[model samples]
Target: MALAFEGKVAAITGGASGIGLATGRALLEGGATVVLVDRDKAALDRLTAELGKNCLAQVTDLLDAESCDAMVPEILERTGRIDILHCNAGSYIGGDLSETNPATIDRMLNLNVNAVMKNVHAVIPHMTERGSGDILVTCSVAGHSAIPWEPVYSASKWAMTSFVQIMRRQMLPHGVRVGQVSPGPVASALLADWPEENLRKAKEAGALLDPSEVADAAIFALSRPRNVTIRDMVVLPSTFDI
Candidate 1:
């Protein structure tokens, strides 16, 4: 497993904190060059110091199409190649659909759905041409279920769920693998938008997973033998329900 990641280069969005950060650390320890992609420069600077050599940062705003599109070429220029692309950057907005702010909808959908596709679109050419690469997205259990409380969020994930499936087939013939790691309620910044009662109850019920847990699943998927494709791995806290 260690040898599998050695000499590999991985570009991860939302790489400054949460699951992305955890995965970046794991990959670095395994001898892979990890590119931390996020809009937070301060966090990226701090992480670069802690993560040491093998770790790089791509300070990008996923919400902006041009910024998002430009990251792949930028990383390729810096690293020469990207063996792994983890589309893990995303935002969360919950509660009644009627209450969803117009601007928030644009931001969340753009980040969660559009940015992911745009990033993938940019990488498709390079990976297909090279004839090898692994692409994984940070999906959600919400994507697998309707979860009425957050319809818009679910709607976005549903789009992702379908996109991942179709993209996998498209990339399969090109020797590039595509998949997703869908996790349940994770103790990450995404919960900052969750209601207080919901967060408290999720914690009390032991229903929230740590970012490292999700990172483990992600690495597991990425480390598998080229012949074995882990299309989707859904991880949930043992106590989590629905």
Candidate 2:
């Protein structure tokens, strides 16, 4: 029999667009009630309305730990339990390191790395107490190998990869599964900051993946048997190299 989420509750950050929204759609179809967390209030309202009653919207800024902490309790208030957490909120910084603004680097690191850590910290204990939960971080192929065009972005993802591994080990004993979905270039706003040349190169090379494909990967991991975990998965455009 296949896995199902008939009564599961999932909260996804960056849920206003891209992979987060796509993943929320998939979970809703699988019978899981989803909370779409995003900083954009308008987008959240629109998306939540589109997703219908199975989905709720929580306007939040993941960059703030307090905002991250508030999501768990809010979900509990409405749904009574949190069965899954997809830390899908993240940003991408592209281009040469010399040309990169240090401040931009700091902001990216906060969203991509620190925010993930904080969200996990806030939710893990609740999951442990319940004796089960799943944490899925949205990582990147940049984490697997160094990309010259976006060194700092790669570093943040590398940090997430490390965090996922460590969390997986630590959470396993407590019945919480931690994993990551590392994708190659996707046609997302994250790529909005990419240097024109790199974006053109990736487009010309057919290296841009669709957000829905990554969503499918997430659903697969989430559907695994309780005793089994998919761990880490990398989804890339077939033509994308490095």
Candidate 3:
């Protein structure tokens, strides 16, 4: 079977583990060369070893503007072109707004909001110059609705969702596609940061998605024909009610 991403180059941030790593594997199986970017050097090395030669690991802190700016250029220097940019790097700070300290808040916004925008800003020109590309984001279901447990996290996702909507239109004329996968309750490290009670509830209810499921959504969006765009897909566990 022919895969849509065969011969393409995909750059996925947070690609060391969880949803990002799963997505990288899918892309590799489909014959795409992958560049895996994450902050953990040890994990990046392990993932690169696991994924083999076709996969490259880049240890970077997306919060660093200069580092973010250098990502696409470095990839292009190695691969000659970047066909897909999956903005999947983000953090979840769960708790009441009042409980989130100033540093935590800053870290959350820098990675979740600023880094995404900066990466997009770096890649759009390259994509547009070539007159085609795909930019997919790993959003959350919380972006579509209010999540009472994590107000600031919800705000960050809402911001990203809005960015995808507006950027899709902006890139339409350039033949670039912008889309997002909004997954609900994925059983990943993101959940590890949540309040103990919230995590317990999610686990007990069995309302959790596998990281591979989110990868499936990403591959679907990237595989679409140039004329078609799978703008927003919300993947939730069967038992997920809200």
* lDDT of prediction 2: 0.89
Each model's lDDT: 0.93, 0.89, 0.91
* Model with the higher TM-score, candidate 2 or 3: 3
lDDT of 3 by residue, 64-176 (tens): 87788888888888898899999999999888899879999999989998999889998998999999999999999999999988999999999999999999999999999
lDDT for each residue of candidate 1 in 74-157, tens digit (9 for 90 to 100): 999999999999999999888987887899999999999999999999999999999999999999999999987788888999
Best candidate, TM-score: 1
Q: Rank the candidates by TM-score, best first.
A: 1, 3, 2
Clashing pairs in 3: none
The order of the candidates by lDDT, greatest first, is 1, 3, 2
Error of 2 at 155 (Å): 0.4
- Model 1 has how many clashing residue pairs? 0
Which runs in model 3 stand beyond 4 Å of their true positions? none
Question: What overall lDDT, based on C-alpha atoms, would model 3 receive against the true structure?
Answer: 0.91
- Per-residue lDDT for 44 in model 2? 84
